[model samples]
Target: MTRIGVITFPGTLDDVDAARAVRLAGAEPASLWHKDADIHGVDAVVVPGGFSYGDYLRCGAIARFAPVMDEVIAAAGRGMPVLGICNGFQILTEAHLLPGALIRNDHQKFICREQRLRVESTTTAWTNLFDEGEEIVVPLKNGEGNFIASPDELDRLEGEGLVVFRYLDNPNGSARDIAGVRNQRGNVVGLMPHPEHAVEPGFGPDSPAGARQGVDGLRLFQSAISALVGA
Candidate 1:
């Protein structure tokens, strides 16, 4: 089975959910400690969302120096797929694994809701199961969800088709309504929404069917597994 590593920091709240998502998607979820510098030979890595390091200095400022991050950075550089969700996204930016930064929400308040997003590009490891221009609804909870970058960087992202997901309703004032992005090689992806939270049908957001039957986010995990397994 494909082994995917999920890192847990002091204040991590979504590590379990991320692991469950991976398991449901037919991969082995490996628990990785923040203080450890090894990855246990996992196939890929996921930096789950949470208030790591107590959100001190910044959302991900302190978590960037965690021992596991060194291995994550090196693996990512070696073409290992990595996905960062919410605060995890912040860490990726702070660690320079991806471009741009996530700042406070334009509304200046913590927001939590099922956010609608469009799959703008499927050229990344985490989004390969989605079709281009597909719309999906997933949970998003964060105080610093707004994504910002220089105009040049925005142009480059768009020009290279690196913007993986675009918010349909402009939830957090992200540039061009971007909800997620991929690195130049498409191996690394960072997004503000918590797809892991929406993987379970009964516990996820309510769908139009009115049965709380939402599993749109599961495709993301499945995509990563497929990417690693070459199936």
Candidate 2:
């Protein structure tokens, strides 16, 4: 079975959710400890959303240097698939795996809602199942969700089509509506939304048909599986 590693740092609140999402996508989930330097040979990795290290120093500042991150960074450089949600996304940036910083929302208040995002890059390992320009709804809860980058870096990302998701409702004042981004190789992706929270149909966000329709998040894990095993 394909296995995906779910890292848990102290204060990580969503590792279980992420693991459940992995199972729903038909992959095995492995628990990876923050103090471990190894990746346990999992096919891919997920640094799920949470207030790691109690959000001390900065949101993900302390967790950025955890032993697990060193392996993650190296693995990502070798083209291994990696997905970072919310706080995990913050750590990726602080670790320099991706380029940008997530700051407090424009209102300086945490926001929680079912967010709508437009897929902008379908070539990434984590987004191959989504069509370019397709819209997806997922849960988003965060204080530091506004993504920012230098003008030059923003231009480069736009030019290279690395901007993965753009918010349709603009809840966080993220630059250019960017809700997610991918590395140059498209194997490492980081997003502010919590896709794991929306994976199971019955338990996720509601739909217009009065039935839950938030299973859209499942495709992200499936996409990574496909990329890993060429399924």
Candidate 3:
């Protein structure tokens, strides 16, 4: 089985959920401690959401310096599949793993809801399972979800098709309504939504039918495992 690591920092609230999602995706879930300096030979890594380091100094600022991050950074540089969700996305930016930064929501409040998103690029490791233009509903909860970057960077991301997901309705006021993005190599991806939270049918966000229960987010984990094994 493909082993996927889920890192747990001082105040991580969603590491367990990410692990469960990995398992559901037919991969072995490895629990990695923030104090550890290694990735434990996992096939992929997931930085789950939470108020890491008590959300001090900023949501993910302090957590970016955790011991586990050094290895994550190195592994990602080597093309390892890595997915950062919500506060995890913030840490990725702080660690310079993904371009751009997540700041306070334009509304200046913690927003929680089932967000609608369109799959913009399916070339990324975590999104290959989705088809381009696919619409998905995932749970999004955070205070600092606004994504921003320099004009040049934005132009590059757009030109290179690196933007992975886009919002159907602007939520946190992200530029171009971008809900997620991937690195130049497409191995690293970060998004301001809780895909792990929407992996299970009954437990996930409700679909329009109210009975079909959406698990649109499960494919992200499954896709990462497929990408690793294929490599």
What is the C-alpha lDDT profile of model 1 across 1-231, one tens digit per residue?
899999999999999999999999999999999999799999999999999999999999999999999999999999999999999999999999999999999999999999888899887889988889877889999999999999999999899998999988998788899898999988999999999988877778854445447788898899998888883
Off by over 4 Å in 3: 206-212
Stretches of candidate 1 above 4 Å error?
A: 206-212
Record all residue pairs in model 2 with backbone atoms less than 3 Å apart, i.e. clashing: none
What is the alpha-carbon lDDT for the whole of candidate 2? 0.92
Where does candidate 2 have its weakest 10-residue lDDT segment? Answer: 203-212
Query: TM-score per candidate, in order?
Result: 0.96, 0.96, 0.96
lDDT of 2 by residue, 1-231 (tens): 999999999999999999999999999999999999799999899999999999999989999999999999999999999999999999999998888999999999999998888999999899998889888888899999999999999999999999999999899899999999999999999999999988876777754344447687888999999888883
Give lDDT tens digits, candidate 3, residues 99-187: 89999999999899998889999998999888899788889999899999999999998999989999999888899898898999999
Model 3 has an lDDT value of: 0.91
Weakest 10 consecutive residues, lDDT, candidate 3? 205-214
- Error of model 1, residue 12, in angstroms: 0.6
